[model samples]
Target chain A: MHAIVCIKQVPESPSVGIDPKTNTLIRQGIPSIINPFDLYAIEEALLLKDKSGGKVTVVTMGPPQAVDALKEALAMGCDEAIFLCDKGFAGSDTWATSYALAKAIQSKAADYDVIFCGKQAIDGDTAQVGPGVARRLGIPQLTYVCKVREVDLEAKKIVVERLLEAGKEVVESRLPALVTVVKDINKPRFRTLIGIRKASQAQIPMLKPSDIGCEEEHTGLAGSPTEVVKIFTPEPRKGGQVIEGEPEEACETLVQKLMDAKIL
Target chain B: MAAAGTAAVRAVAVRAAGPRSRLKQRTKRYRLPNLRLDEENCTGCGACVDTCPFGALVLEGAVVRILDSCTDCGACVGSCPSEALILERPKAAGPAVDLSAYKDVWIVVEYDRKGVSHVALELLGKGRELADRLGCRLAALVLGESVSHLTDELFAHGADLAYVVEHAALKKYRTDPYVETAAQLIRKHKPEVVLLGATTTGRDFAGALAAEIDTGLTADCTGLEIDAASRNLVQTRPAFGGNIMAQIVCKRHRPQMSTVRPKVMELPKRRDGHKGQVVKEEVALDDEKFLTKVLEFVKEEGSTVNLADANVIVSGGRGLQDPANFKVIEELAKVLGGAVGASRAAVDAGWIAYPHQVGQTGKTVRPKLYIACGISGAIQHLAGMQTSDIIVAVNKDPDAPIFKVATFGVVADLFQAVPLLTEKLRKRLGK
Candidate 1:
């Protein structure tokens, strides 16, 4: 089984602090790490490789600095890492990004059986790229997967449980499919000492638009259909009165307040 | 039959061709910003350079040079006093098909065995507004096995027309058949805008459909409106963990697509017997072509109300200290007839199941009231529930950020306060 996992590097922000004058995030000092959700994807891929006896390749598309993310994934036991970086790929939206990623997979690892991706990137939280890549590749998309029930490589079949709005649904799809997993899927493991040494000295290749057969018009902001016309910060919710007193007094006062506000 | 339904709603004057045609005309996938520099009228004063947020412009030799970072956002276009800067788009071949041929605003009405989802109805309310502003019709696209009967409800909820496609292949929300059926109808009967609920099924369906039709789609929009000047759908959504909001536009796409989160919009009042046109259409779908199958649906045990649809929620976090302590939270929720929620920390610690988690990764809920007990309000957790109508925080630490957004805060131990509060509420409501 050859499993390919797609990952992204996102700004590590517990909560963003706003620049009052600029009305934008103070992004200068923040460091970049692998998107938290993608860790699960990497772990799942490694687990699949561990069980099935094959290789796990991690792929990411970003600026040059994104290679650090691929290195981290390598340290987490992925066999290979590919970094897709080019001037043409800057300012790409989810549509263009997914298209570029799909093109890279086709150019580099077309023989793979399964592709894994985090349900969504934390910064964008769009969750569209997984299905978008599936569409471009003409494969089945199983999103929000919480469990991998079975992987019958002989039958070229895989069954998984995906979380929906109301409940979890067990879905079975053919091999060569794409899956976006949620945190409930599995716990991501830490980097091992041997894996870190190998990753530090690993030769990760960086692919450009030409290397992956991506057109300049289809891989950047110019190729994107949607554009952010404007950006602004939402008004913060105001903190209300804090009734600090005895537990009995606070409880009675809160219930009285709810009753007065017609919330109780 | 498809063309007949299409022709009935063809009421608008088409303008230029859809943006997809122009997209095909581009030779270079990536190019530097095509800014026309009027150097003859240039003062080289550097006002445009200062206005560029990306620092993509640098005043080189008393002339502004556009850098590779220029995103063509057109932010500096209007800052030049001498009108020396103009963001230029490529002059492509004429559009193959008229973009104006797409006339109506459509809400892809999602229904299950339980009937229409609330998010679908919420979309109708917003879709009606968008259609009204655009001076076009509001239509509902219902695709299901036996969803023909839903047209009345669609019309009652402000849809001016109903496009119903009935087939056993669409019995459940499978991506292949649903995308094929919806794509066929959309190609035949063009719509200027398509709205969908950002539910799991809707997100899955819309992403594939957008990629299939080669259009743009904005996900989990909190605001939707029509730009009066350009008649484009303006979609506003929260990004960066809800730290900021962005307004997006699909000016080139024929049908601008957007998926809105549930409970973000107001539900429209339903009018019984509200009359509208019902356009029934059919498409051929072969079950053999589908590559996926649904084996079973397992609802999480002990969750009577889905967190998204619940009116009240009582969420606990690591402050509970133990998994068994969730019983206190659960007991309070039971007394209040509310659902249980947990912070990421608690859920990560295996104190509770993932379904009951409430935060960025868990769920975004807007219940009538939210009670946060023993939870240190992480930004992610706050992002999910800050929109709830009322928040009451009970914590030992007064400085926990959760108190900042809570309508009422009690700085006390939850073990002491929660049971007392539950008892008081139970006696007051006679539960």
Candidate 2:
């Protein structure tokens, strides 16, 4: 009945900048927030915890500063928090990332029955980590999950509604399964005064690579197969011509422009 | 197999030199590693085995094992439990540039009874750019019966050469014949970059062709560029509900392929007097290969707007209040002869369907004119339609983010302004 939610802290891009020369995001002095989608996963896990009368554990892998994200999750009703931070885990792509995370989850697999993750991380957007973690864990993985239709704790079966291109599919999978939730899953709950106080006093468990039994060579940049040879912001969209006039004249001018552009 | 043998021969010759030329020889031997499985850490979970496209993984004696036939695409590595699987770069691998055999840029010209899709022309434009950059010819592979008449049009639209694969079996898009014919054509005239439209048929056909040829194929690309150093086709696409954009490169594959979304690129201007060399190629086909017979094409009936090709779009948001209120925006769109769009908020509220939604989680639109009615543009919403040629904002909130991007901003209630504007446009149009 216990649920574990994995969260990530990504750059708050509105106030962030990417170093042009290094092809890396400038993180210093930039505000970092819980990945927006992860909020939904945390909310879903909290909801399950509330219904099942069990604890919810929030987990994250990042630098020491990522404790802020775990604290935020704890404030939002998570019973416990875990931070898998090690210098060796830096610069991990989705492949290496899922590896380290899966190992961390496996290290504590006996304590949790269900694992939840956001559909994808905003920073990476690979959407591969959840599936990757599921693959590594050998669990039934449901992705792009919009709704949890039913959960039978006794039977250890969960029915989830996955969002597909045409319609929703109700998939029934056994417990100890992984579900990657989409943004539409649930609205995250706000922290109460007591919850915030509890979070402030909460002692989050910190784990290193050795603690999780993750090989040093396979948990970070060294383990990553693919490398971003270069990263460049796309050219800014050029301003287009403004056909300023009365509505009628503007419409006429637009039609003419479209015709001239051979778009019609 | 022949290509692999030729590559092996070249690799052997390059390696035959002594240790004094080790650095030079090392620059040519790029050996790709197989998927690695760490047995001690494996949880005996069969996830990777089920997920692997190729049967490259097997659960053997409490651990997952990698087969020798692994292509190293790293599909299974993501699914391994205990983080047991890894796709690592082989050490001291040299620069892997083996794309010299492919010399031209080819675009698959997708056409139907309604003439060619605009994406074909858009690819022609992109193809022209890439060809010019590479100093290679831009060609079109027009596959259909009686498509010979389209060759001149292809040339006029930027194609320097047109290879016609004419056959009745290749008339309508089905996977088998189209892929076989396209594969044959590619095998004969290897293209450095093959561009396809991210349409239903184009995706189906292109995926099959890429699988047949055993090459990398990036889908739904919004941007394409040539890496100056590697001369590699960098295919960029919005991933994870447009949260981040990914640029993918087919580093060690020939005929680097990508499918671009329709309307994302500009169509080349057609010149009347332009001419190109047309090479007519015939593909032998039979009914057996094209087994899936078209039962009937039941086309959806409605005032169907080709939103992708729409030059102007009038989009509404949840501020419109009700589903019925969408009619006001629709009326304005009708008068303006523009398609109606909605923000994800409105769409999620069931005020409109997904097709009308204009946002990051929805469709990325680049219309000539985008009219925002009662829409406070969220960053996700702006990501979709911010590339419009001219944006006009009509919102009650004066500080709505849409106003910042709007060429014309009016601080007024959209309910009042939309009806008045629609009436004015109706009168002007004599409707």
Candidate 3:
């Protein structure tokens, strides 16, 4: 029942503003948190670990500052945490990112039975990396998974209900498979005092490309098949009229104007 | 016998390449029939050849011969007069190609009950732009039962060519068969780019199809540009909760793919006499190839809050307090002849179903008039509706963030303001 979960660190946004004049994101003081969707993935993994009486290991690939995210996951009850952070990994798209992750899993936790990932990272929302990893590893993929029905460790099989466009479909896949879980799966547990203390003092071993057998040609933007060419802001519309008057008078004016326009 | 094609259409998805016997490969398998081309009932009318977008089947002498290019899309199965075309699910492999051979830009024309979809029409307008810039031909692949008549509309919409595929297996939108048909067309014709609508159905299977063909697909793109020097499509979309925009390109992949959200692009003007080539293609069908079946399609039940398609949307938040209070919101919507929408907070509070929620995790809506009442402007909510043409925010708090994006702002308690507005509109409209 051992599970390996992949999580990513994302900016706490929807509040973070962008500078219209500079055409840049305002991230100077905004804090970062684990991707909300990945939290569900972690929870499902921990739940499986509990049921089978085995350990759960979490992995992440990002810049050096990503260690904070790994520490947070450890604090949530993962037994082991590994971070893959190197300058070469910068600017990697979903393809290269999945390559680095799959390589790390192969090097670090090759004996694992099930590998879990969030359905998508809210930041990118491609939902490509999970399937990409499965293809590269030559394994089966079950995506948009909502519930875990059964886990037959001895039979090397697991059954789950995957959410599709219409509804849920029950699917069974041989173990040593990859699953991208959706938020409907489970609610994550908060860090406890004992778990917090253990995580705060834990030493997370950071690995580089060569350490995990990832080639330089397949680890960064150079290895990525996709490229970002240009970026511009979406045009904003003209502001509407905000009527000024007493609440009742303003309401009357709105109705009168709409009627004159034959709208209401 | 057809040459072993680079891709197989709707065959068993599992690869039995690892020395597993055909018998051993069976799982909780479907007992239904596989894709079979029954020769006894052959009419040799060559209709199947015209219906196969992949150019996989041909009428030679008097018999229909499947080519090596067959991707196994079952467009030909149901069109045969004597039921000559049949299918049987088999262990399969993916299409392998020399990337240089691919050309042109193709759009998968999707339709709803109301004929061709708005998203598909929008893509045609955008596709014409890209095709012109790249100096390549623009094409549309329309698939369905008895849908060839739409070719004239496709041509008028600016598709230089239309590939019409028809089959009984395609009467309904099924992921397995649709992707099989689409992937096989890519493998055989080798289109440089493919566009699809970023609707619920598009998002459901777009990634899986990309995986099947071993290609990259960018989802929900708001902007697309051709990189002149590289002849590549630069796909751009909002990232990190709309804080930043990321422009992505499939640098090495042969056919770059993207799913554009509906209403993001303008539709092409209809030209009454526009003409183009229409190639009819065919696909085989089998019950085993389909992973799931659609029991019944329930029309979007009660409230007409199809936020995505609505021109005017009045959304409420948790400030409404109780489910009963939604009546005021509905009243306002009814008077305006628009739809009633709610924020995630309202949906989470059990005031409404999730279909009415407007936020990042919810549906992205870009209506002409978006009125937010009793809703605190959260970034998540704004991300979904910020693109609306006219935004109006009403809240008791004067500094609520919703006002930032609103074209009109009102600082008043919704209880006093909303009902008054609704009453005035109802009286003024004689409703």
Which candidate has the top score in lDDT? 1
Q: Give RMSD (Å) of candidate 1 vs. truth.
A: 9.4
True contacts kept of each: 0.47, 0.01, 0.20
Model 2, which residues run further than 4 Å from truth?
A13-30, A110-113, A165-176, A241-264, B1-221, B224-313, B318-324, B332-341, B344-370, B376-378, B388-413, B416-431
Q: Model 1 in CAPRI terms: which quality?
A: acceptable
State the local distance difference test value for candidate 2.
Answer: 0.67
Residue runs of model 1 more than 4 Å from their true location after superposition:
A18-25, B1-97
Per-model chain A TM:
0.94, 0.91, 0.87
* Better by DockQ, candidate 3 or 1: 1
Error of 3 at B252 (Å): 4.2
What shift in Å separates residue B164 of candidate 1 from its native position after superposition?
1.2
Instruction: Residues B245-276, candidate 2: write the lDDT tens digits.
Output: 55667666668887787777877898987999
Predicted candidate 3 versus true structure: per-residue lDDT over A58-87, tens digit per residue: 998864445666777777888898787664
Compare candidates 1 and 3 on lDDT and give the better one. 1
Global lDDT of each candidate: 0.80, 0.67, 0.70
Residue-by-residue lDDT tens digits, candidate 1, A1-264: 899999986656634554559544443334456777789999999999989999998998865445667777888899887777665665567778788889999999898999999998776778888898999999999999989999988899999999876789999999989999998999999888777677767766657788999987776666667776666557878889899789999999998897787865
For all candidates, state DockQ relative to the true structure: 0.33, 0.03, 0.09
Question: Residue B237 deviation, candidate 2, in Å?
Answer: 5.2
